[model samples]
Target: MISLKSPRNSAQSNVSPPVKLLGSALIALTVFMLLAPLVAVIPLSFSSEKWFTYPMPGFSLRWYESLFASDQWRGAIANSFIVGTAVTIIATPLGTMAALAISRPETKGRNLLLLLFLSPMVVPVVVTALGFYLFFARFGLANSYTGLIIAHTVIAAPFVVITMLAAFSRFDFRLMRAAASLGASKMTAFRIVMMPLILPSLMASAILAFITSFDEVVIAIFIAGPDQRTIPRQMFTGMREEISPTIIAASVVVIAVVFALMATAELLRRRAAAGLKG
Candidate 1:
């Protein structure tokens, strides 16, 4: 009684249950708020309703049927795939060459050259599109598949260049010298000593170029017409005439495909890093 007890150790006291409940409720509310719109679309895509109303009344697969039946959609998908594949095929090697040239040990003004190569990625897509439109219009390239592929390649190549540049930067020059001293031909040295080291980055860069070309829209719009419309272009046009849940379904598919590609790229990168470590 004379000596007062030490102050209560409130610091050791358990957090109030109500406070914990409130925190969890807030977190749940935040997650729902972020995902609600996306979740809402899945049901609406299946909704029997003809309009874009939320909290669908019932469900049907009519939109999926309509999507498959549309010749325009099929044409657009084909066009996008063709353009994307062509862009990847052309861009990857060119980008790798450009990166190698720019990264050469004695290259003067390498930064400026690198910046020039990367300009497409830095510049606004709309500006690039407009410039290409005018340039191609002069050359009668507008609305042609060739022009569309070229335009997309311009944008996609930078991604490949940047990725491969990173790989090139990590290269050890001693390996090249060692191979040469061992009497290997220059081409053989590159193929045997350098190619395997950089192959992962090359693959990753090609995948990125493909994705960039696949999703490109601004340049496509400027160059593509009825004959060359891409999937994104089709989606853009579809918004003008009618709204349907099929768009959501298509978007979900695109997202899934992109997610898979990104996952693969990550795996490749990790493998490359591990190889380097070894």
Candidate 2:
């Protein structure tokens, strides 16, 4: 039998060496450009010198010690986790529900609703901050954790929705129908069949929502009170007022903790996949 593959298609599928080298070079350059600042910052965070200087005198964890020792910084760290957790809790379910409804083939006004849900992600943070500030001030929520959590949830929900929608796109709806045909209620079908299949995506979305809220400073500045200061807000204030090594140390601490958590999660996911395969 003659091969069905066309020469042009084969040529396109097998990229030229020069093109591949160029693409690899571009990718490496992009990665370096993105990570250079972080690489610089991470080292500086461990510098023994009081001020930022290249070729530091020695390494020290004094900044980290100072950060943990400070009442304000410690409180800010706690507040960050509180707001992030609350935002993740509120946004995850809401986003999942919205995604489920919008992903349905029979859903009406899906595009419009999706746009509405995603408007926060599309709009500028400053614009969202201003709107939240005005709206929150009217209700005496301008300087509260409640306002901060609510504001963060508005922005973070879009990530959850996007992640969930992507998972839903890959999911087979037939399993849901089959469960329903077997006399399972919609809720039962979701819990038994859909949830297990999409649980990884659900976890990912929650993590994204938490990260979004934790990293958000513009909205926190507009909404959070002095008492409810978050890590990002505190970092912003530190940058404006004092460029202390503690700020860099805080960055390192946050980066390390989050990275470790995500790495562990990935390991667990891989193990689960391997076990299932086994």
Stretches off by above 4 angstroms in model 2 are 1-12, 261-278
CA lDDT of every candidate: 0.85, 0.88
Candidate 2 structure quality by residue, lDDT tens digits, 1-278 = 99899998888779988998999999999999998999988888888999899998998989989999999999999999999999999999999999999999799999998999999988999999999999989999999988888999999999889878977877789889999999999999999988887787788788888888888889988888899999889999999998999999888877876777577546644543443333
TM-score of 2: 0.91
Highest TM-score: which candidate?
Answer: 2
Q: Which stretches of candidate 1 lie over 4 Å from their true place?
A: 1-37, 40-43
